[model samples]
Target chain A: MEQSYLIDLKQVVKRFPMGKGSFTALKGLDLQFEAGEFAGLIGPSGSGKTTLLNIIGTLDLPSEGGGTVLGHPIEHLKASEAALLRKERIGFIFQSYNLLQVHTVFENVEFPLLLLGMPSEERRKKVMEALDWVGLADRHRSRPSQLSGGECQRVAIARAMVKQPSLVLADEPTANLDAANSHHVLKTMQQLNEAFQTTFLFATHDEKVISYLKRKIYLMDGQLVKDERV
Target chain B: MKLAWLLAWRNLMGAGLRTFLNVLVLSFAFVMILWMEGVMVGWDQQSKEDMRAWSIGAGQYWHPAYDAYDVLSLTDAHAVIPKETVRSGLVPVLATQASLFPQGRMMPVRLNGIPSQQSLLKLPTAALDTTMDAIPALMGTSMASKVHLNRGDRVLVQWRDRNGTFDAMEIELVDVFQTTVPAVDAGQVWIDLSVLQELMMLPNEATWLTMGEATVDSERMAPFVWKPFSELTRDIDAMIETKSSGQAVFYVVLLLLAMLAIFDTQVLSIFRRQKEIGTYVALGYTRREVVWLFTVEGSMHAVLAALLAAVYGIPLLWWQSVVGFTIPMDTEGFGMAIAPTLYPVYSLGLVVTTFVLVLITTGLVSYWPSRRIAKMNPTDALRGKIQ
Candidate 1:
């Protein structure tokens, strides 16, 4: 039978070594996400939300237990296989707007497509479309250092969305943005989610971001406490 | 690899001043190395040519008793000239030790006797054919300067005859000539072969015969041992090789300075760009790929430097080769043949070898610092946290 969910995790436990002992970040966590879902993992600091997000992104693997993401067992994937999974199927956005500071907005958005070995003409078209989606088409020539914080984040969004990956993993994507820029970034994400049916998973505690998620899963002290659908 | 090159080039260009400084230092090294090596080659070639023209003709045949290194052998070095060898255009040279009293100052000098009409050597021997009241002789400018003797000046000369009898006579300095070869000029005097043979009572005897022709059969030269050109000029070749070795140290120091500048920049770039490295990982590059990217970036500096060197170095080096570099101080006293002005000769091999060596070295130093990136955690790197 075909899998119904794009991500399926069971009893995923994550432990990090600290001093002579270990600190457990996630305890017996089970989660699932279907295609095209717009969801958030809501929590306070040290509640293991980002750690869970990293696992789902395949940036990390669970210390114990295993999960399947997009049909591949995440725990057993080699480093190269994980990189290919991210390259073709996943996109990441960070809060501080981790754009290559030296590259222009157009070049930054064009990076993922270049990695895909897309022809130059096709890459230019896709990069332009992605920049237009974030309302930064006119600022494509400006470097990240030359742009405002919101503009920098939008360029990052353009970079992540350039390849139109099936899943987008965002960690505190609005933590550095003001109220107005946060709403603008969220609306951009909301529209992209509904338009392409791409799954959006965010790890955040921001109220503005929480209100925008269709489903919110709350965690406390490394354990899930509540799940709600608005 | 192409993507790495494109990104590396852009990154270096974005660096602006820092990149310019590195390329400038490396290009300076490139030009200097080629210039110095070219000079060494020029010196080697000049020395050989000067030696050939000024003293060692095609080759020589030494009397069996002759040993240039052993002064005592000169007494018995002379032998009867072979008729066949003399007929084959070989110029007989008779050498004997003599004492000269010039301006009341006594000095010992090597007296060389050559056929006045011979054209096998570049010496002004024809001047020795004069019928002056005193026996005519020639002195190198160096020897004349040291003895303070001028043209037409008579100096008292003393020598031993074939019968071991000491004889003295006044010889007029017919001419004072200039030559670059110190071996033939320093502490030496030249006179007509017939005059010296009659004076020494050793007619038809010669210490050595210089060949005017390009090739001669050593077997026919019998009692006189033939010395080929290679054997005759071995000392000059050795001295030049030693000089070339000494020059290698200077080139090494220059290359090291450029390498250090490049290495320092690469280390700083890697240290400061951890976040950028992590971003590359998130954008689908493996840690190995990122390492390769940085390595290529560093190697590109060498490529840029080579191009930059060609821009300015070509015209400058070509001008030097054409105009030549003149030594400010006197070198005739250095006891070797050295022209006043040295024209550098750059071979295609020299330029290519230097460029390839510097490129590989730059790649190594760049790769050395880049290896640290392979061990970094993507999560930590993405957060700009040093690990």
Candidate 2:
């Protein structure tokens, strides 16, 4: 069966003002990702890969042209509506595993559900289920600092998936991990993707990350160089 | 909303030293404001009471017939003091200066001739016995000690009459009074009206009739021929106005300083948390949510500071009341009794005012920075970019 497009971008552009000049970050790019697709965005440093991911994540607006996420026009969405879309339909995974340092693993995972005003019992059930899926059930009570690099990323994954968002946008997920931890994190993400069939969009320059995706989009100097399906 | 609060609280806890410093500075400012307000309120209350005691009632009296420059009446006491004075509910007293010869040393004394009945009622309880009969004339302890007059000593008094003729009489010093109010204890001599009338050659009259309480129609006293004390001490009105204005200026300066401190603390807090605030926005929290989060945090700090201030303020106020603050004795001279100790009185209105002032300052200080947080681009915020 053919899949439906979860995110679609056409002629998207982003620019930043710099010292009386403008730096064009993304220039007239077109992209599309289907629902339940495990896609990778691969590029060199400063090649606008992260900028594209941010635009897709509804964290930034295109300077010109438009895009759609979950069938909603990104350009026309107000800030509040964009935030609501992000809250209800999307999850984010940062390169640094941006877990609130003061909260334990369980609490971190419980955050989004709490924002949704879930009851304590419902929140606990969802958070533990996410942690169980990420294989961090035993470490739920530990703080981020107390965890290893791999454990912290697992906690981040649990936090991302606890709300069961339709799409997960991860920025350099294994950038800070060692070889063994990176392998473990990639394996866990793959397991989650196969089990839940949630769409995963990863932005990275690392070959190890690029090799893990079923589909890959390549960019060079703010322009798309290749789009590949595996 | 709960998530934001949880995140804010977590961030606050994570940044322990920063949060502690902010709380300390905030609480200190709160305490200082409350303490200053307490002192001002206490001083105002003390001033009002002192005014009442020094001037007798809220009103005063003098002979309407005599001009400010004219010699005061000593013999024509009836012109000011009427027979139906008590019926009018006015407490009448005769005030004049007399030459005192005590143990052969001469000194000037202020003789306050109060009616025998009214004097007993108005005098502080410490000065008189339970009986309605007259106690021997009350002399200030300082004056009594200076002249070496014991309780039974006789002092010769001389005074001028309304016609500028002089007369002399003798009175026994029976009671000595002392008060924390310094000026009153230095030169006052309280005497009976009958003795003062005979001594000044106005045998059946009183010189100045002072009312203990305000008359129902003080305007009636205007036509009956007596000037109120309010007219005699017109300078006090100016003094009170000057003091009030000075206090206002001081409060304004203090408030400005407090606002600056609050503003500085909030700006610094936002600057330090730029990354965190950005992260929150990037994590699906709207700008309004972010602004509201910071606002709630600021309000929490303000409320905590106010609570701490109240805890510290009440005891400090009580201490001030009990011990009192002293001013230089030699600065103001004898006839004007300045209180040696001043106490601050606490009022609910003052407390509420201080709390509101602090809350408003905290809220305003948080506004601009929270707006900045709201306006920030999530991409920049995520990259820890601050402008």
Candidate 3:
């Protein structure tokens, strides 16, 4: 059976104002992704890849047009409601592995659950399971600074997947890693994706990242130039 | 809420140097504020105690004339004095000036004459008994020394009669009184009331009466026409008011400086963590949540500082209160024998107020920055720039 589309972006637009003029970061783009689909948004620098990811992540609203995510109308939701939706259903992984530097690996994974007001026992169970999935269960007590690049990315992945959200947005998650570390992180993420059946969306210019995705989205400037299946 | 608190705690600990400097500055400010408040309250309480000792005698009292110079005539006393007033508990005393001669050396001295021994008993104990009869006069230590009189020596008390006739009487000095306040005891004599009446030639009248206990109920006392010692200490009251105004002005300036320091540090902390705050917002925390989180952090800092200040402050204040801070022995004219000491009295209200002030200022200063976090696109935060 074909799963329904979880994210649908229709003619999304974003603009930036420079001195005496304007810069269009996203010039009327349309995109859609089905549930459980592993997709990659491949674009060069300044191609509005992060902007589009932000819009889908509900971190930024479209200046023009409307869309929906996970059956909720994005345009109609208030800032608080959008935040609620993000907390409950959306998970984010950043390029720099934005785990709170002061928190240990386990604590970073437990953060979203804490925000969700989950009880300690349940949060521990979920966090441990997520850490086990990332193969970082032994390094649970290590802080971000103590971890290597691959370990940090794995911790970030654990943080993203611990909440068991329906959608996981990864923005250049392997940009900071070496070739070997990058391959390891990608393998760990693919394994988690298969095991949890959580949809993965990657915004990256890395050919390595694009090759791993089942669907590829190509962007030029602020517009989508191509969409293809592997 | 717990997550926010945890984040705040760890952030405070993560940057050791910044946290130390911030807490040091805050603790110093806290100490200054606590000390100032303590001094003000201590001074007020001391003044009240002094007043009670001198006039009201710890509680309240009623007197004959509102103005000290408006003598309590026999007729006026009957009209103003309450009908069921506790007479036995009241002490009638005469205060006047008299000329004295010791071996041909003459000087004027203030004389306080009480009706009975019980009245003198209520006065605080100096080295000598405050009570004296015709044969046993209590002379101030300074007066006794100047007059070259031993315990058995006699002095001539001379004064002008109501008719302008000059008269002299000799009395034996039985005891010499030494007080903590040397100035008060130096030029005064306490004698029995009958001897005073004979000397002043007002055999049937008393100058003012002191109540050993409160005769006027606080509620009823305000509306009732009553006299107080304020009339006698009008000049002193003016001087005290001037001193109070100066202290208040000084404290206001100090508090303003302290507030500015608190404001600056909190603002700097928020600005430095702007990106992190934006990330928190992007992680589904609202603007209000951000504000509350920082406010709670500031409050926690204040509470910790307050606890430490209390530990150090209480002992210092108590020691100062008990032993007193000493001034140079050679300092003259001020006549303050027991030197001024600041005793900070800690109250829950003060702690609460300090905490609230810190929290509110932190919330206000961090408000705009935290709200900016909510307004930023998460991608910008992730990129470490809002623009």
Candidate 4:
């Protein structure tokens, strides 16, 4: 019943079916996040960083755990309830920059607002604001296919930020970009984080992404190894 | 649903040629189903019109003993012509079996006798009122051609009377008229009703009376049963029904082919665009919403096809209705009533029905493949993995 943290987990475990046996993606772990925190779940491959991030994002549920995200019990949320939680309170940014290829940058960024049934004029204004935050306001008419890797990531960030959700879950958001593009994307996220005071949770092992985080939680073989604050 | 439609429309338009090709094939089905159905309806209408004009005017009253399919029944099918029926302007017809020797070749024919000056029917009965020495007889062009006789030719006609007495006479082919109704033409001859009555020794008698302007609804007159218009045109109606069933098969196949293309596209879209589907879910769409999105996307092909079909079909179908379709071969051999050129008739019901059918069928076809999305994992789909 402790609903103080934005996301709270205790004794959480996640398992996947693998040919007559089970693969434990995450071991018994205790974690918590507060409002407006900039943090990262840092680990190498097969170390359960993405699994924990997914659990917090409400995209997946822990097999045996008591978890709450934004005052909603993660394990008890129905499909629509989970979807609504994601829709109104959480945003996601993937490493691949999964922008709709057929849509212009403006349309892509405006999608979440459209889902919320926002009025078109107001939706357009908010979309322009999000694009300005990412410094891609002038490229609103260009499609994802027409944008560079860094620009597409920026558009994804704007899309995640357009609705101004309480939390944003980003998984390896800069993995596909070069060093310059990676630093550029990171700077935009850092600025957006400070300007909006929105909580940012990332699942990554990249040192560049790790360097920008104010708090880092390290995982090793599905167990929490360390929690550090800069 | 509106948002889904808008997104589907944009997606289809963005797809460009793939969407166009599917629409093109589906549009072909739309036009063909409508066009062919229209022609069938027109054929039915034309046949009924021709029959009504040339033969059975409004309806007919047949003698109790008459069986059109039984040739021997002609011997006893005659009854005295009803005075009240005559007063109602109905045309009485008397038919008897006869043998005609044209150029010494014998052939059996039905000698149908109608009033020479009757205006109730479109047959050239007035041509029977001739001043020639021999009896004036009129036959259809097919019969005339079959007998190899022209106008002014004389042929020997022999027949039997009520008393079983044989008699012979020479009749002149006064008129060889052209008519589309096979019932009124083909192996039949028309002459003065009075002359046939006198020859058969059964005066004031007729086999049947074709109702004219004033339709009679009398069952009181025994030995004469009233046949309504629908009853009289039963064979033609049955033939049209059979043709309609055949047409249903044709268009169903046409629809299936178009649906196959849509089904293939939907299957391919679900597999090839896994990332998009996952993105949709990650963007806060329910799996069911994603399924509906794909279904709407597929169904939109029919909408686009209908519009595209309308772009070309309206003018083409209109032109066809006006100019009519001409059969490439002779229709005379077709036993029932048919025209050399057929004009199609389109109704609002037909067009709307075809449109709805294509829409529903395409939706079902699209939905069948889209159900797979509900089972897909968002994490896996985001990774573009086929699950």
Candidate 5:
């Protein structure tokens, strides 16, 4: 039963302190994600899309009820355990293309594998293969600052998929890109998800991203409003 | 640990000028500390060497009544030389109190009597044996200049005989000697031992006997204390130790400036690289790992600085040792054993100790600020928040 779900959340509530009292970010939300699903948490700002993405990524703990991610309890996990879970099983792509500015494209893509303690020869082979997938194999030596918006996103996707993780969490992955680059990054992620059958979870309000997701979950004011198969 | 070292090295290299400036500052500290300490060590060795040559040859045998500091003790300090010491090694020297009138001004003086034919010590006392009008004597350059006496000049000397009667005579200054050691040259006059004994009415008696090594049998020499070279120079050693302790403050200040540069760099790196730190965490690095990465980066500054110091410091320190450092003050009457120019002597231990001190200091300075990373919230850090 646990193998069927990559992420399983039940009665999850998240709150953050605002001045004196606490503000509820997620209230009694239940969500289940099956393996190899291309899903998006679609909501506007203040609807907790980023919050949910962070929770799923084990970057935050639920304040009220808890859930499991990759068969490990998410709420109040030790820092080392959470790091290991994220390191071995989860991948993240941020809106600003959080590629290390100083590292070349190859080094950035190879970072996660390095943390996973992969040896040099195999790590090089896997990194090159991931670069080949993102179509940035020729730009491996180029730094992030030298790349365009679309190229930087391609580098980020290459970095995320280099480890071939079970789930990749992208937070507004196309926010900084124009329409052409947005669709290009989205279509690349779509192809990577289908080819590797790796689960992809996106937090975005962008319509272009919505059109690509196989399933969309809509949240409004700390509550899930709709779930639909696109 | 190897991965941390590798990434830390890469990060430092990528930092470019900021890293270079920190390393340069730390390197300066290493050079300054080592140089200063080398000078002190050189000074200590030179003082001991000069003492051994000019004044206390290996050791000395003092008469029970003799105390070099108290002039009254010198009057009664003389005793007949021991028979056992006369054959192989010991050379007797008669020390007595006297007064001189040079340029019509009264000056207190020590009249040291040395055998004209002895080679057991470094004093140029052979110059005292001369066929001159008055008793041939030698005065240090300091005493010569103060008394306005030249090599051939005669000065009036007053002394006491065996009957406690006062006597006056003119003594020829056969030679004026130059030496770095103040003990031999300050307010002192040297005369032939036979002549001094004849004048003082104390024949065949000496204040102390100098020998080549510590071979004097203390049991046979019952009333006399045989002072070895180690005991003879204990005061000088203590003085140098006290001076070194006072100088440790300067070393601390120098190291503090270097450490401040490193500490500032580490704190700034933590602030500026928070995003990179978060990225590291998100990539599955424990917060502890990130701390280690930053710590290694900071401590590596000392390593780089040590290399940099070797590039420039080696030649400079070697040249300084060869050329020696000249003091600005006139050393003519500076009453202690010191040379006009001091040559630095650096032992292997001094160099290694200094390096370890800087390395440990840098590691601590780096770790103090980097510890904050372990407490940083991963989610906030990922957003590049200031927390």
Candidate 6:
């Protein structure tokens, strides 16, 4: 069978109001993401890489055209429904490593499962397993602040993957990390993708992240200029 | 809501010092509000009791013209004792305006006549039962202290009889008693009923009959107007209520200050933790759920405060109620039945009311700033951007 698309963006357009006139961030871009595909949207500044990521993550709505994720129409989706979509299906990893600083590593990882209303014993097992993948199983009790930058990023990864979501959207996951830590995080994500067949998408200009992508889509000036296999 | 509460509790605890300070201030507010209100309520209760025990005995039957509040009403307030006066529970007492001299200073006084053996009042009149060489008299400690008089002291007493003629005599002060009822203690003197009857030439006539523990039908004969205990003490009750209402303002102010701290902290937390808020949304919480979490977190401070206040307030209040609150100032100066020290009474209702009030107040304040989240854009919030 032909590869199925988990994400299908068609003629998507996004504009933001600036001063008097509006600024177009994404113009009529079409993109498809298949299950278990490791893909990246690569571009320089102002190329709408993050915007497209946000739109696909269901954090933003298209000004004109829209898309679908897991067969749910992105346009006209109520805020609550969109939130439910993000909650049940989409996982996000930010460049800033947006881990809840106050929570311990385990608590951070267990957050999603808690939201899913999972039982305590099950949550514990899943959290520990996710931590194990990030190689932070022994550091589950440590707060985000107490961990190193690389460790914090790994905790963020654990938190994202803890619920075993269908899709993970990473925005420059390695933007703040060194070469060794970046490779470690990418390799872990790679293992999770292969092992669970979870769809992985990245919005990044980082060469290290770009190198790991099975497919690279290049954008400039708010339009896709190229799309190709790595 | 369970999920919200759990997450809220975790967040508040993780906040550490910020949470502790808010809880501390709010707790102190709880203790202060409850303690102050309990004491005032206790005072109101005590005053009513003191009035009942010292003066209004369960109720009274006043001569139609008799008004204890009006000095002029006393001039002709006396009437023949109502037939109800013969009842076992009725204690008929005569009162007439008189002038007394102590240390050569003349002062007006209510010279009341009571049966020395009567058990109806707590007047300590047994002192008058003594057969002294001079006239046996009883004056409250406040009157005695004010006039520089003491027990066994001979002083001049003068009064008008039914003939409207002035009479004078030197009578010995037999006893000076202390009483909590201001009306009973201030500038009042007590003497034998028979002697007063003879002196006033109005046999079996009285201004009022103080009802004892038993009830009497004063309406049977209708010589005097029957005033129930509550009606007799109406003014005092109103005064206490008015005072309590005024005191409520201070309590609100205290709570507001405490909640102000909480409100300020909530606003600051939302402002500083925009990214965390976004992360929560990204994790799956609805905006409304986040608002509720902050509300519970803020209100939980009150719960913590109440527990903390209980740790100290219970002991302090208990000790006070037992020992009684002493007035630091002279009791004679208060002009009313104010006990020197007031024992605070904390009823279960009062405690529960204060708890609920604080929780509601804190919850509302927490929700106020958390509303900013409802208007927040998660995409921008994810990057720690305002708006």
Each model's RMSD to truth, in Å? 2.6, 4.9, 5.1, 1.7, 2.3, 2.0
Best by TM-score: 4
Docking class for model 2 is: medium
The alpha-carbon lDDT assigned to residue B303 of candidate 4 equals 95
Clashing pairs in 2: B42-B345, B60-B228, B60-B229, B61-B229, B91-B210, B91-B211, B92-B209, B92-B210, B183-B337
Write model 2 residue lDDT over A1-230, tens digit each, in one string. 94547898989999989999999999999998988889988998989999999999888889998878999998898998888888788888889887777778988888777777789998898988999988889988888889998899889888888888899999999999998899888888888888888899999988788888999999987899999999
**TM-score of chain B for predicted candidate 6:** 0.95
Tens digits of per-residue lDDT, candidate 2, B341-366, equal 66666677867877787788777776
Query: What lDDT tens digits, residue by residue, belong to model 3 across residues A49-78?
Result: 988888888877778876788877776878
Model 5 compared with the native: what TM-score?
A: 0.93
Measured against the true two-chain complex, the DockQ scores of the candidates, in the order shown, are 0.64, 0.52, 0.54, 0.70, 0.70, 0.76
**Model 1 misplaced stretches (Cα beyond 4 Å):** A1-4, B61-65, B78-90, B200-205, B209-213, B224-228
Error of 4 at A61 (Å): 2.6
Q: After superposition, how far is residue B271 of candidate 5 from its true place, in Å?
A: 1.8
Error of 3 at B63 (Å): 5.2
What's model 6's TM-score?
0.96
Q: Best-fitting candidate, measured by lDDT? A: 4
lDDT (10s digit) by residue, model 4, range B104-223: 888999988899989988998898987777789998888898899898899999999999899989999998898889888888988899999999999989999898778564854456
- Worst 10-residue lDDT window for candidate 6 chain B reads B213-222
lDDT of 6 by residue, B1-387 (tens): 888888888888899998888888888888888878888888888888888887889888888898787877877888887666776458778899999988888899998888888877888877778776667898888888888988888999999998889999888888888887778778788998877888999998988888877766655747788788889878777888887899889888998899899999988989898998888888777777777777888888888888888998788778877887676777768777877778888899999999999988998998899888888888888899894
Task: Report residue A93 deviation for candidate 6 (angstroms).
Answer: 0.6
lDDT of 5 by residue, B1-387 (tens): 888887888788878898899999899999988888898899889999988888888888899899978988987888888776776478888888889999898999998899998887777888877877788888778878988889899989998887789998899988888888877888788889999999988998989888776476666654556878898888778877877888889889988998999899999988888878878888889999999888999999999999999999999999999999998898876677778898988988999999999999999999999999989987788788964
TM-score of chain B of 1: 0.94
User: For candidate 5, lDDT tens digit of each residue in A1-230?
Assistant: 53557888989898999999988989889999988899999998989888888888988888878878988888869888999998998999988888888778998999898888899999999999999998999999998889999999989999989999999999999999999999989999999999999999999999999999999999987789999986
Query: What CAPRI-style quality would you assign to candidate 5?
Result: medium
Better of 2 and 3 by lDDT: 2
Backbone clashes in candidate 6 total 6
Clashes of 4: 0
User: Clashes in model 4: which pairs?
Assistant: none
